[model samples]
Each structure stands twice: as structure tokens, then as C-alpha cells.
Target: MEEALPIRKIIHVDMDAFYASVEQLDNPELRGKAIAVGGSSKRGVVAAASYEARKFGVRSAMSSVLAKKMCPHLIFVKSNFDRYRELSQRIRNIFFEYTDLVEPLSLDEAYLDVTENKKGNPSATLIAQEIRQKIKEKTSLNASAGISTNKFIAKVASDINKPNGQKTVPPEAVLGFLENLEIKKFYGVGKVTKEKMYRHGIFTGKDLKAKPLEYLQEHFGKSGSYYYHVVRGIHNSAVKPTRTRKSLAAERTFSENISSEVYMLERLETIAEEVERRLTKNNVAGKTITLKIKYSDFTLQTRSKTLPFYISSKSLMLDAVKDLLFQEKMKNSVRLLGISLSNLNNEKKEQQPEPEESIDVQLKFDF
Candidate 1:
């Protein structure tokens, strides 16, 4: 067996209800209300929901019909991709100050390897606090972060205290943390896998770890091996910052709206192949894949999922894309379909954005 790498400090930063928060940030009227970013058409799906909306069961990829049913006064706002993109770039700039090994999962989340950062900060936890502080000052937006010895734990930790909070799992606490983590909370274990694991009586990481490797492989196929290793907190994937954070994205705006899920899959297969070619041409691999859809009314939605390991193969990318497609049902005619990948190993950090000036920030991050 290959030996594990020495423990390194990693931080996973994710903005809290990013798009909805952005809507609230720019428009003060919507703060602390049930709001989502997407068209209000009867055949539209929500792209993102505010924390307040989430309390009422509103969620991304959910139909507006259901959202309004859940929250009778639900408010829908149009998405502004250009503004979101600009804000995302600003967030990445803050990350670059700490380390060049910043792997952007999307416009709102990234994994940062801060073992040896530019700030010369000794404590990764402190660095996470500072980054979150800077983000608030620069964008007036809240962020949550996870800090730990590896990417998997760090990513999960960030979610423990969400919406303007931070959580850190020390190296000594990694195993204990994993043992207590619910099986459903494990990264990459979607609904189907969760059900399968439940059938196997694996309700927590502890139970998952109890299964023999061969038994898992027999029952879960190749992914069975994947589950066996994760329960042990053995994920060794690095925080990869590619030469460019701009991923290999292929998009098509249909001449006419497409509402059929079957037709959408056909287009996705073609787009995934194109993304695969782009990754191959760049000589890189991506562990995270995203699917973007635009409704006939011009409102857009994006859904993404990350794998534990990097992939450049066309079929593999297609597999993930297809998984994303079925995760939600279409509520409207789709006018555009796009697929992209990030987490490349060669991404570099050369240009950094300027943070907002004339702002005073207090260092009051909780433990």
C-alpha cells in the first residue's frame, strides 16, 4: 500500500447561500426574507435560495411551484451572472493572498492548501478567520470555512457552522470526527448511494469502516472501494490550483427551448465530451464538474458535484454529468445547456483582485 503523505493544513471556504446572499447584498429590501434567484415563471426552477428561504424548505434545483408552496410568499429574482462572476473573482483574490494552491470548486466555494502560505501565518485556523474577515469587509458578504488536515474533513467541517461561521478539526481529532459523521453527510454519497449504504446497515462512518474491503467491492462495484477508504479518513487528494481557474466549459443556446429530460441528456453527453477534449488538450484533470442550464425566460440554474479523485476521461465526466441531471427535474423549457470542470492541477495565481478599501474589520471569529 502507498504510504500517506504527511499531514498538511487545508481549508475549505464556501460562501453562505451565495447567489441569494448576493441578491440580498445588492438589494437591501430582500434581506432576511424568503427569496431565491431564478425566474418566477410557473415552469422555472430555483437556482439558489436564501438562508431564510431554506428554513422553509426552499432549495436550489427545486421548482418554483414547490418553493412557493413551501413558502407562500416566496420571492424570485433574476440571476446576474456577470455580477456573480465578478464577486467570485474577488473572493479568489483573497484566497491567493494565503496560498497559490487554491482549488476553486465554483464561484462560491474553494479548497485551499495553506500549509505554506504567502502570509507566513503559522496557524491555519487563524488564516481562515482572517480570510473570512476580509471577505466580509470586501464584499459585505458572509462566508463559512472548514479547516483540517485534509480536503474531505475540511470541506465537511466548513458546513458544521454555516452562514458566517468557521469550524476547525485538528489533526488529532480527524479520526474521531469521521467516526461520528453520519453516512449521509459523507461527500460523494448521494441519495442512491446513501440508500444502498443504509441497506448494508452502514449509518455512520464507524459502521462503514467495519465492512471488509472485498465485501464493499462486491456489493458496490468500483465505488465500494471508494467507501472503504473514506471511512478511515484516508483521502489524500490535494488542493489543486490550476494554471487558470477558468475551467473547460462548453455551452449551447438552443435555437428552440428543450423541455425533455431525455433530449437534455443527449446534449449533455455531447458537451461532456467537449469538456473532456478541453481537459485533455490542456493536459489536466478535474475532480469537480458543473452543469449550467438557462430557462426559456432567461433565468439560469447551475448544479455541480465533486468527486474524490481527478478525472479526465470523457465517459467518467459524462457519468457525473448524468448524475447531476437526474438529481433534479426540469420545471421549464431549457434554452441553454452547459457543462464545465475545475480543480485542474496546473492552475496558477498570477493576477489578484483588489479588496475593498476604507473598511474596518474586527477579528471576532469563534472557535
Candidate 2:
């Protein structure tokens, strides 16, 4: 039998109703009310709903018109992204106090690996508690944390306690914990995937572990390997820092609308070259390319393609941009053109056989 690796202490921290919480913290009167931060018009959607609003079935992304119908007294507040972003930075500083292995997941959630922490604290649970305390003290907001031997369990644990609490799963209890977990509760297992699992007779972790790897791979494609290992309680993923952006793009605003297809393609080529030069200066290859164009009518559209691999070559990017420009119709006079590339790589993950899904846990936070 293979020896078990030493236990790795992982913590997953997620702010409670992040945007809504920030609003509540900033305006004390908003606390304990059914407040939503988003558009108030029928066409607008709710960006975040306070816990009080949730009681009326109002939720994030729900149309504001419907949200108001759900709760006639629902309060609509405008989004203040600038303030929220500033607060997110303050919370990030709290994570740095323990370990440098902090991975941000948007402006709200993050995964922190404290297996070998700078705080010299051996217990991941204690670290999570301390972090929560610090965040409350610093931001005047509550956050829930989960601590466990691996990222999968830690993430689930954090959700279990919720809103303003912490939970931990010991290494030995992993199997039991998973066996009791619902299929929908599994990270990355969405409604569509859950329905598929039900058809496959996979209702829980134990049910999942019973399947052969080959069977899962045949069905789930790229995500199959993940289900195989996570059901068995194995995860080897590490946190990845948010690195600096490597490319900048500039676009020309045409004075008059030009409807010529060939002209648009040529313009795209020039923009792609500018983006390519910037990538070269920074020594980066972006697998994804985004094409931006604005029409004379002020309507805009952006189309993108991600190569199987990243490249910094100007010719290659220009060629790809040309293909995209030709694929779509030139509905109006081209008023502007732009191009950008992201998904940079110093080392490519796709080059290797995918490390198990659970093993790519930290990378999941980037989503």
C-alpha cells in the first residue's frame, strides 16, 4: 500500500453576501432590511441581495421587476463598485498576515494554503478563526471559513458554517464526510452535471467512488478525472497568485463609418500587432484573444477565441484576428477596433496530462 502523505492544512474563506454585506456595513441603516444593490428598473437585474431580501425569494441576478414582486417592500440600492473594490483590498491584506499562499476568487472569496504557514501556528482551524477575527475588526464585516486537510473539504466546510462562522474537517473523517455529502453540494457539480450523475446512479461520494475511471472519462470529458479523485478524498492543487497583467491594447476611433470588410480586417491586423508587441515586451504568451469593435450606431460587440496553447507571435495573432473579423457580418460602419490577449502562461498546464481535478483545486478559485 502506498503511504499517505502528511496532512496539508487548507482554509477556504468566503465573505457573506459580499456586496450586500459591504453595503450594510457602510450604511448602518441598511442593516436588517431587504436591500438589494443593482438596477431598479424593470430591465435591470439584482447584483446582490441582502439576507433580509433573500427571505422574499429575491436573489442575485434576478430581474429587479420580479424581485420587487417577490417582496413589495424590497429596497433597491445602486452598486458602488469603487467602494467595494477598495474594501476587498483591505480584506486581502488580512490574508497576507498568515501565509503568502493566498489565491483571490473575485472580490469576495479566496483560498489560503497554510500547510507551512508563516504564523508558526500548526492548526489550520486556529488560523481560520484568527483570520475571521481580523476581517471583522478591520472591515466591520463577517466572513465564514472552512478548514480541512484539502481544498475540496475546506470549501464545503466553509459553506456549512456560513455567514459568520467556521468549521473544520479532520483528515480521518474525510471519507465519512464525503459519504454524507449530497451530489449537488460537491463543488463544480452543477445542475446539469447533477442530473447526469443521477442517471448514472451516482448520488453521493460513495456512489461516485464505485464507478471506474474509464467510465467517468467516457462521460464527463475533461472534468471526469476530477470526480474520480475527489470522491476518493484526494486533492493536490496549490494556490496561484494573481500576477500582473502583461498586455495593453489601444483602439482607433474612426471618424466616419467604414463598411468595407477588407478595411476592417486590415485594421484588426494592425491592432493585433500592437497587442503582440506588448506581449513580447513583457515576455508572455496569451492563449486567449479578444476582438473588440464598435459600430457607428454605438452598438458594440466583442468576440474571442482561445488557442489550444498560448503564443506571443504577432503573425499568429494577426492571422487569428483576421479569421475572426471575416467570420462575422459588418452590420454598420466600423467606428472603433481593438484586440487583447489573456490566459498567459510561463508554464502551460494543458501541456501535461491534467493533474486530477481535486488536484487543480486552487486553480478553480480563479473562476
Candidate 3:
């Protein structure tokens, strides 16, 4: 008989309304109030919203005007990246006390692998609790966590309890846990994919598992294979310690729409400078330059050019962006403009795959 593979213990930690929470934490009067972190201008979008604001239908990525309409009493605060970064680093430091295998998804969320950790602890559930407690103690902020055998399930489970809580799915329970979960709760199934799954009578994990690999591939293409394996609790992606920076971008939404190409070029010059600064800070150069444009009516368009050689200078990038900008006439007045660089020299050419393991034995733990 083949020996059963060891089940990996992974945890997904996500801070609750991280940006808004930090604002509230710093200003005592803002606590328990509906607050959003971003500009409150006519063209402003919400970067984050507190739970109180969320109750009123205010959400991140929502327009500030709509958010105010949803909650008239909502307060808007500017983003302070320096403070956010400092706090994020402090929280990350706490994670290293237990495990070095950490993958940060953003300023507010990360995945950790602790199968053989520095703590020498056996229960991932307990580890999650301890980490959350430490975060609360150190940052004076609430966090939620999910403990499971893989990153995907852990990420999904972390949302079950919001603000300050955690959930654990042991190896034996993974299959059943996934089987009963709502299709929308699957970590990677976004709005469009959820609607597509719904149309195919796939509203739950069980429904997804019933479809054959061939049928899924026909429907979902490359992503179909991912769905097939993950629903069976077979995600093999590890918590990578270092993640590659795929692209760098800078963009601005104008207070008023501008139709002049001269004005557009001027704005593009500033955006290119910001991109160049970021590239210099990261010590990287890219061959691909993409210009993103959002019209007054909210329709979006992108133009891209890839050079034979990498370039990081603002002047060179501006020249390339100029070509893309004038390559097509403006369909409408522009409300937003952005420039991004990709195909970086710093990106790894190949990635070493994590060893594959299969679980056969039931995990015995009190979660």
C-alpha cells in the first residue's frame, strides 16, 4: 500500500477593512462611524470603506458620489500609504515569528504555510488564533483568519467570520466543506464567472464536482482544470516567500473630463514620470508599455506597445505612450488616464514547482 502523504497546514490572514480600520484606530472619534478612505471629489472612487459604511451599500471601488448617496453621513479620509505600510510591516513581522513561508497578497492579506513551523505547533487552528491575538495586541486592529490544507480553501474559509474570527477545515473535512460551499464563495470565482456557473446550474461545489473534466474544459477552457482539482481539495500551490512584481502603473481620474489631446499628453508626461520613479525604486525595466483610458461614459480602452529592448526612462516611456495615445482618435472625452509597464527584466524566467502530495489519512485534531 502507498504511504499516505502528510497534509499541509496553511492559514490565510486578512485584516478587516484595513485602510478604514487604521483611520478609525488613529482617530478615536471615527470609531464605530461610517468612514471611507479616499477622495470625496466628484470623480473620486472609494479605496476602502469601514464595515459601518458597508452596511449602507458603500464598498471599495464604488464611486464616492454613489457612496455618499448610499450613506449621507459617511466620512471620507485621505489615504496615508506610509502609515499603512508601517503597520503592514509590523503585522508581517508577527507572522515570521511562527513561519517563514509567507505570501502577502496585499497590504491587508497573506497566506502562510506552517506544516513544520518554528513554533513546533501541531494545530493550525490554534496557530491562527494566536496570530490573530498577536496582531490585535501589536496593531490594535482586528483580523480574521482561515486554517486549512491549501491556500484556496483557507482564503475562502477566512471570510466565514468577519472583523475578528477564524475557521478551520481539517484534512478529513476538506472535501465535505468544499462540497457544500456556495459557488460564489470559491476564492477565484468572480462576478462574471459566478453568473456563468449559475447559468450552467452550478450553484454549489457539489454541482461543480459533478461535471466531467472534458465538459468543464469545454466550458471554462484552461481555468476548467483548476476548478476540477480545487473542488476535490487538490490545490498544490505553495505559500511562496517571494512574489514577483508583474507590473507597475500610475493613473489619475480627472475632476472634469478633458477632450484636448494636448492636455492628455501633458497628463501622460506626469504619469510616465511616476512610473519611471517606481521602476527606478524597484531597479527594474520593462519592454511593454500600456496606456489605459477611461471615457466620461465609463467605457475603458487600452493601447499597448512592446519594444525590442527594455526601457525605464520617463522620456522613452512618454515617447512610446505618445504613439499609443495618438494611434487612435478619442472616442469621447477622457475621465481617466493610466500608464503601466510590464514584461520586466526582474521577472523570473522559470518557476520550480512544489512537490506534489496526496492525502489518504484522516487528520486528527480539535479545530
Q: Name the candidate that leads on lDDT.
A: 3
What lDDT does model 1 reach? Answer: 0.84
Q: Give the per-residue lDDT digits (tens) of candidate 2, residues 65-89.
A: 8999999999888999999999889
Candidate 1 structure quality by residue, lDDT tens digits, 162-239: 979999987566667888999998888988899999999999999888999899989999787667776666666677
Reference-based lDDT, residue 82, model 3: 97
Model 2: which ten-residue window has the lowest total lDDT?
A: 358-367
Candidate 2, lDDT over the whole model = 0.81
Residue ranges of candidate 2 with Cα displaced over 4 Å: 1-4, 242-285, 288-343, 350-367
Q: Which residue pairs overlap in candidate 1's backbone?
A: 241-347, 242-346, 242-347, 242-348, 243-346, 243-347, 243-348
Q: Find the candidate with the highest TM-score and give its number.
A: 3
RMSD of 1: 10.6
Q: Give the per-residue lDDT digits (tens) of candidate 3, residues 36-128.
A: 999999888999999999999999999999999999999999999999999999999999999999999999999999998899988889899
From the highest lDDT down, the ranking of the candidates is 3, 1, 2
* Candidate numbers, best TM-score first, in rank order: 3, 2, 1
Residue 331: error of model 2 in Å?
Answer: 16
Q: Which whole-number lDDT from 0 to 100 does residue 115 have in model 3?
A: 92
Query: Which TM-score value belongs to model 3?
Result: 0.90
